[model samples]
Target: MEAQVFQALLVFVYTDTWPEVEQEDEPAMSQHLLVAADRYGLERLKLMCEDKLISHIDSNSVATLVSLAHTSSVPK
Candidate 1:
């Protein structure tokens, strides 16, 4: 996990909220957070990340998002 990703996870763990991340960083942050949340059994966080990511779907990001979905099995 990246430092920012871990830091956001820690923030969420403690405060039930994520730190302020820039708009451009939200997708990647949510992706990493989704994976971390699953690995740690943080179901609500995982679902929130999934929802955030879904809203970010776009032509430029779709392929990567599909790959993440396949690899992480997040929707299932």
Candidate 2:
């Protein structure tokens, strides 16, 4: 369940389909980072996204996250 949620959030973050409006339930891309951070225990990834990563992470970040979740050295 967590992984699924994480994937969904990742897609939301790394896609142009993201909505412009900021709402409580509808978080900004940064919020997805926070979710990933919490679920995967990726503090650095979260901070990087919060600080300098998200802006640079292209649309492919979602696919990267999916791939990472499937097979990567990173512990999740």
**lDDT by candidate, in order shown:** 0.86, 0.50
Winner by TM-score: 1
Q: lDDT per residue, candidate 1, 34-67, as tens digits?
A: 8899889898898889889889989998898888
lDDT of 2 by residue, 20-51 (tens): 43443332444455556656765655554455
Clashing pairs in 2: none
Model 1, position 24: C-alpha lDDT score: 89
TM-score of model 2 (CA atoms): 0.30
lDDT of 1: 0.86
Model 1 weakest lDDT span, ten residues long:
67-76
Regions more than 4 Å wrong, model 2: 1-27, 52-76
